[model samples]
Target chain A: MTGTELKNVKVLAANIRIDILKMLEKRGYGHLGGSLSIADLMAVLYGKQLRYDAKNPDWDERDMIVLSKGHAGPGWYCALANCGFFDKEWLYTLNEGGTRLPSHPDRTKTPGVDMTTGSLGQGTSTACGMAQGLKLKGSEQYVYLIVGDGELNEGQCWEAFQYIAAKKLNNCIVIIDDNKKQLDGYTKDILNPFSYEEKMKAFGFDTQVVPGNDVEAIDEAINRAKAVKDSAVCIILDNIKGSGVKYAEELMANHSVKFNTEEMVNKNHAAIAELEAFVKGAE
Target chain B: MFTLDHERKMGKRELRITVADAVNELMDADKSVLFLESDLAGASGSGKIQKAHPEQYIQVGIAEANMMGMAAGLSAVGFKPYTHTFGPFATRRVFDQVFLSGAYAHNTINIFGSDPGFTVGPNGGTHTTWEDVALMRTIPGAVVCDAADDVQLTWIVKEFAKSEGIHYVRANRKAVRNVYAEGSTFEMGKGNIVKEGKDVLVIAAGQLVSDALDCAEKLEAEGISVEVVDMFCIKPLDKELIIKEAAGKKAVVTFENHSVIGGLGSAVAETLLEAGVSVKFKRHGVEDRFGQVGTADFLQKEFKLTSADLENTIKGVLL
Candidate 1:
């Protein structure tokens, strides 16, 4: 990736992070840790890799995304809005009554969200289905499935991984965000997911582990995954729970946080200002 | 209106084979119609289609939840996916997937839930699903149906193929007593008065439709006229027909091979009560009990879903 391209993608990630914090702050409380963790990967997708038409969100020939760990819907929504899939003003309507921007990614209500996911481990299987369907139709489209490390506790993810491996659906790129935190507590305390790399290898996926915050590495990993022939592929993002937000990163329980407190709101405001300035300078 | 066939003999083709044949016909006509099974291809009689149309067949192996999500995914990408599993596995086992991924997502898929209720038979309590209809009915815009015979099962499979939304068809895997003639067609959300009379009305579905017919015949011999209606479509139930038949009748009874709590009986009760057509109503089914290990006949009697039970229920309401 060129320096200009890398810088542009980093700016895209910062914009996504800013939007997510803004939307969550407007809502007073939302899923923060997991959503913040996937901002860079979402940037790598919407900014660089994914083939989609914001004008024609239903474009049949475009690549698709299934955010399986749907608590991170804020991140996905920010990416979509930044890419002009929908108006940026809609982000303020998150989880409101009669709002299309739901707390989870709903394909029926939202534009460019190919699968409806909130229930963990489900989108993995859905992605496999989409990949197999594409292969059946002989279309050269990819399905980028973003799964949370915590979401893997649900056995359905493993079931889907087994199917993807058995079918060798390289068209479905399995991206696991190892943010290491779930709703109740840390994933290691809740359920020890030893090593994502070893598990994906055992499941027959050619795996790659990359720093979650690095947009360049994420882009390169996706390219390598696409180049592999006749084999299932996976990328494990080794990221912190509250990835881009410094205040959220140090806070012990950042899974879902309230922005109602003055300290938290001020901290979020400060972070958003910094991200916006970075984006402005890059642009 | 449905054309009722008075022939009470067994259908030549097993219900599973009938489902398989209809699905095969669909796949043959449209390459987009995919048949997905969760390692129950042989049990569902879809193994034939798997052999013939390997390109259109997907065997997802024992993961019911993943299979449902996969079906929804296939539906999302413009493929009309038909998924088959036993009743419990199809509905209760993966209800969240069916609701959120399939129905809520508007990624519609046709689900064929085989071996409902007593039809599961020797598969025992673990496999028997007495709550599938109730569970399926709870899904918004989900079309739920119970096939009584090969003819009806074939029509359900073919009709739901073109229909949108989450369509669930519950039928037995083995042969069921034929209640409709070959080439007989039925409409969705409509009921057929197989045997009409004035004294009482018995709304029935699934394999119990044949039992209800026999009970009506026996009640007629005893000078008590009984009307038997095949309410195949259970979710968007034939409320109009139910209200019409239930009004001014001496008694109303609902018969099914499922639990009396939330199956055909509950739907009928809700419809009749809401319509304010009050009558001596009774639910003749497994009286809120789990299934047990037995032959189909033994389980039918054990659950009080036999013709004899229907007669007793009506008598209790009348005499």
Candidate 2:
């Protein structure tokens, strides 16, 4: 968590924001709030935390990441492209016909995505499974999971939480992006998930609450999770609905939106400029 | 309905017991083969494996969705995982996981969906999965299979152990009437023509194989030449054998222990249509009805899936 590392991760996050905005803007509609909210965490992961070979994406011994809230795929795709998992040119192909990158993460098609996930609760379960599998093989690899706060509405996520703790899958690290917004509206208006830390602890996880916007805290939480031997860790990453983009962040509910109209396109461009200014601050 | 009168339900425990043993042996041979249960180890007749190989058998505790993810995770790291539960729980309960984690990820995990369709009997509509075959068939590259008898079930468990990707193995927990002889070989995606004739083609699967055989025998004795084919592999259907045996026959009657709409009959109808062949065809099974508590005879009479129903359907088609 050095200053240089923090700045580098911040730049990466800012760049991912730009990538996501540009891609979705061109596509005219996509998940914005969830994708933007997770950018910093993805930045810290691909930039400083994860140990992977971009050249050998399928290396047998490499650690894994399954984005259970897979609608945030554009943000992850940006991170992978920045890390050289694939060419950056492929990012624009998001959700298009014959594109490897779809609206959801497909491991078979995408280069760096470890598990295929679009359905909310399924990824958490798969991450737990990967943790157990890696343990059985006696591999020291970690399975990193990024789950959305709203995604917890699916009962499968809780089922996965219980299984991970029951199996004592300490090799897995779950980060809950408590952005507090979903497709319909605010999570409170939809289904109020009061406290993730308490719920996670009840499910037998070694839980922590961290500032989602802080890369240093995210990095530290990941390391802390790795140190625990008998219990899995759940870090509730408290974040703003839209992290860096002002236009997106200003929306009362920017969950999944469209920029198909002329006014929205101008607003999108303004958001891009705002993200660019944020990168200068990182420098 | 379909009745093999003198033959009792003797093979149920024997087959289940043998499966438990085979699973244990497979686990012993390969450290990677992990066995998972959804708190149904006792019901699935694997109490011995539970006691013997405690490490191998993981009781996922009524969490079928999480069980699927656990199996997928185990498969990701090169472990051959066999997830066992009743049919409805395995397919309908956690279908999204089976689709994304299991099939889409191309991870290898053998799912044993025991007690398909009416075999759950008293378990009723809530427990029985008449739409599992239809549901599983929709998944791309998924190997959907239904066991005909004791030998086929045993063989499928062993074969799918080494095969890759998501595979569905649906069968009854009870003893099935043995059809293939000991050491008889079977191929995936290739239907076995158990009996061949010119007048009628009877394609059958699961516990209904015996009923189909009985019906074919009765029809044959009545001077109607009947052919019976065991369509064990339902998804990667034996279209070659289906066309080879069924296309030119006087008529085709498909028998299954599932709904007539999306099970074996639908697959056969779609295949014939795709191949551009016109033939008199009828699907003999539960005619779009929810299951109820009864003997297979009573249920079959209610749903018209018995041998008598098969005879009537065939006669209506041919005569």
Q: Write candidate 2's Cα lDDT for A191-260 as tens digits.
A: 9888888999998999989998988998998888888987878889988888877888889869888987
| lDDT over C-alpha atoms for residue A32 of model 2 | 90
Which DockQ values do the candidates obtain, in the order shown?
0.89, 0.76
The DockQ-derived docking category for candidate 2 is medium
Which candidate number maximizes DockQ? 1
lDDT of 1 by residue, A1-283 (tens): 8888799789889988999999999999999999899999988898889999999999988999999999999989999999998999999999999999999999879999889999888999899899999999999999999999999999999989999999999999999999888888889999998988999999999999999998888999999999999789999999999898898899889989998889888999999998888988888
- Per-residue lDDT tens digits for candidate 1, residues B1-319, read 3466676798788888988899899888999999999998879899989987999999999999999999999988989999999999999999999998899989878999988888788999999999999999999999999898888888989999777799999998888888987788999999889998999999999878998999999989999999999999997988999998888899999998878888899999999888888799998888778888889888877887789888988999997
- Writing each residue's lDDT as its tens digit, candidate 2 over B189-252 gives 8888777789999999987877887788888899988898989999799998888887679898
Give the lDDT of residue A157 in candidate 1.
Answer: 94
Native contacts retained by candidate 2: 0.83
The superposed Cα distance between candidate 2 and the true structure at residue B4, in angstroms, equals 17
Q: Identify the leading candidate in terms of TM-score.
A: 1
Candidate 2: which stretches are off by over 4 Å? A261-267, A277-283, B1-13
DockQ of predicted candidate 2: 0.76
